[model samples]
Target: MITGGTTVNGTGVFCACYIRQSRKKANKSEASPEDQRDKTKGYSDNEGHHFVDFYEDIGKSGYDPDAERKGFDRMMNDARAGRINMIVVHYASRFSRQNVNIVLMQVLELFQLGVRIVSVNEGEFTSNNVMDLMNIIMRFEAGHNESRNKSIAVRGTFEKARERGGWLGGLAPFGFEAYKAFVDGVEIQLLRPRKDESKVIKWCWETIKRHKDDTIKQGQRHPGSLAGLVHQMHVDKVPTRGARVGGAWKDALWEVTTLNRILRDPRIAGYMAEPYGNGKKAAYRIQRNADGTPKKYGYDPILEPAEWWELQAWLDSRGRGRGLTRGESLLSALRNPEDEPVLNCACDKSMCAYYGGGTSPSPLYRCNFRNVPGHNGNNTMVQHHLDEYVARRIFARISTAEEDGDTAGFLLEATKRFARTQEAPSNARERAQLVTERHEAAQHLKECEEDYKSVKDKGPATRRAVLEEMDAAETRLKTLDDALKALAAADAPALPIQQWINSEEGNGDPMGEGSWWATATLASKRRFVTLFVDRIVVYKSAMRGNRWVQYDASKRVSITFAGEGETEEASEAA
Candidate 1:
């Protein structure tokens, strides 16, 4: 009896057939988008309504917000524009499984716009009659409840499987393959190390540990450890896990980000990470027991706990003060000196590498803020000259300390200062407490959910209280998770000077030709500089010199070593 705008046929009502399939169907028995479309079309035909258009949202959740459901949004827009006066869906659930109140409001809006919604399984949804209104409310509430219960059940199943050391369904982590086997007469998926991939992982750990000692020839380039691994994998034609492309499986190229993820993933250490919910950021939070030790799976681990922690520590150390820099340069760490205050121009702004065209075409360290009005100073210094000056100063200081028999004290104080500036040493007791708090919060969340389900029909007030408790518990869990992640990322004790000395042995003197400095990679030299030097203040050139004359760096630069109160002028002679 509802009137509609005239269509091409000009007589009967124009109906838009809407179909939705939320998630892939597990089996053919479950209704698909095609099935929903057919049912809606048949009902439209039976009612003598013209099927003007079809709108389908395949593999889109009905509970998603209206903006996320593209087909549904288009259908509503068309109905509002009088292109169609009714939306015909296979069932009310196909239209929406949003909150009951939200769904009711949408339906009311449609009715006010002179449009109506018809569900083939249920009848025309109308607010005119009390019974019809009650039926509409019950239909949407039922759909919402069904989706919520399904989500809870699925999470519980995954958690139980995880606790039992079973691999939840997904592509296995790199360096491992998933296999199904019967455990006590029940088949479950499990992960096992893949031989070739495992070898690559082992090589990565070994290479990264010795990365600091890697040397580059005069013209050859070294991309440090993480990027170097990617290049080596490509050169060796190392195959990554195959992915399906256009119906055929293809191998992906090794990437720096992928390598980083593999190195950071706890699965390599024989533990599964907790599954995070949608919209939550993922972190490698290993499932742990009440005693705060990682829970093990039924497979061999590629890296021991100590090795994994060592790798993490190395990564944390590298991540700090990392930024874009021109090809292998000693002052790379000083490029962004906001945090360390190590390298500064006369104008107080951090100096950056500037490659410009002039009579002196080589790269120069120039103040980034020099071009601003009223900032007048000789802010540029030849890169090589400054680098040589700083390196000589460091070598002289080390040599002096060794002669004075104060090397041990100097190294100890320097290590402590570096550790303090870089990152706080992770507290074991604090980490354990955070892990325990997360466990308790998770348990409390489960209890709240169960209470909500049990008392849903009791009263609105009771349901709200339970939901509030669930939210609070979830917030607490998130906080604890973030704290645990911070603790994991905190730098391990800075590498001892003796370790550096040992690694650099058999090279030569610390300052002479063929020495550690001559062969050390740019990354290694940067680390060395950051560990020993606290700040370098550059002043305007004090002496007039021509291009033919050797610039006197001693008069223009001051070097401040870590744990030292006074800044020392650069030595006149190396």
Candidate 2:
């Protein structure tokens, strides 16, 4: 009989069996959960102990503290609650492979609670016996060391395989599938393009490219948004990867999130990516060489590196929180010289486009948040009026520069300023450092604002102090923003302004039908506006007549030209 104190129900020692198998050995034949449970049950029965229950943690890693082992926790809880006098396991390692010190503490805690731990192979452990304690400690140490060594060996093996372009055995990325191939006389898995999935990926890139080309060359707007792509795919009945449902494979529908993932994945460009951590929301960074180029696997690339980079640049230029929508109109890429969105309501929310119903003639830009409670601004303006007013102002500035024989110098300076707003830092290390600094600054500013809000009912002196802190944080953030802009400017590529200036269309009158401005693509017009304008601020119309009557652009609009400190009313009479 087992020599254990504190028997439950005054009958025999109540024992609970704990079984664990790490994910690495989950599929192995040896030391399975069932095998461990059977051995522990036989050992407990041989010792005349009553087996009350079994706690099994399958495919769980004992070494990782963050790994959730629900069964192990429940077993511990049962022991602490005096429900079980003994705990049985096939081996000490099956109970835990945590650090030796942690295991020792757990064993001591169990012993203090009058619970004894029994291992089928290692025998019983008692608090009074020095030999038993030492044996338990040594067993835990051995388990930990074994796991550590195996981890190191496995990591080294994976790294070497990655260096040699070998697939490390997991589901292949969306556009490809894994296939067995002979490498160095050894059969190994490699990625091969899956035709159906590859076609979807190719279609996405082609659509974006065509949309961009048409906007820059033919002044045509096309439906190329992520949402548009999803709609078209549904209409065309494009096949996504199938999922098994009730033993039958069912075709999955394409979604924006899925398409976004495909667009953002570096694997499509044939580069390996390293995950940040094991968290569910953890991001991945593309592995790069010393020269900052992405490290490529041996698989055939689905998209060219240049094409992928260009796509990324375009996406980034769209800014945060802006939904991927149709790339239409001249103001799609509109921003001030400082790179801030130019169209903001008096209530401080950014304006959005609103297409009127079939009865209306033109689209309108208005504050989408005007209907929200406590928001009072209802700023709305016709889209074409603003577009034409801005276009005319830009053309006049270019005409003045040309008349003064300073077109070359004027265009160069303007292009450089515009490029700074559009470009990002090229040096990866510098970019990462800037990003970290920006995040910290933003966090500090947020804390300051939260503190100010929390202490609003406090003394005036305290509120003032909090206000000062907030101002300081805002200043620091602004300084970081300026630094980022300067860094981007240093890395900005030269614009093709010289070629545009030399064309025959450039010499004609800008307001005339034959002028470059008249025929310039929407993308080109936006580029011109960004080069010459610092900001465009719109105010509510003051006309006392019907709201639908044509509003004067000069009365409601203010334009701040680049390199100017003063804002001027946008007027044709200027």
CA-lDDT, candidates in order? 0.69, 0.69
What digit string (tens of lDDT, one per residue) describes model 1 on residues 321-372?
3333444457844422124547766555566666674556777777756444
In model 1, which runs have C-alpha deviations exceeding 4 angstroms? 1-11, 24-29, 64-67, 126-130, 164-169, 179-190, 209-212, 217-225, 244-251, 274-283, 286-298, 313-384, 391-544, 547-550, 565-574
Compared with the true structure, what per-residue lDDT tens digits does model 2 show for residues 1-574? Answer: 2233443667568889998899645575338877887899988888787777888888898887788999989888878877788899888998788888888888999999888888888899888899988998998999889888888988886676666566786767678888877777555677777777888888988887676434321232345767667888888888766542212436577887777767777677777765544544544466644323347778677876556655665555453423332335565436664446655554545566666534346777666665453244466777888788777766666656655663455555676676655665455456446655564456457756877998999999999988877787788788878977677657567655344334454555454555566677766676677777766666665544357876567776777666554677644321
Candidate 2 collision pairs: none
Model 2 bad stretches (over 4 Å): 1-11, 41-50, 178-196, 212-223, 235-253, 277-281, 317-350, 357-362, 371-375, 404-410, 413-535, 540-550, 560-574
Taking all chains together, each candidate's TM-score versus the true structure is 0.65, 0.69
Q: Model 2, residue 284: what's the lDDT?
A: 48
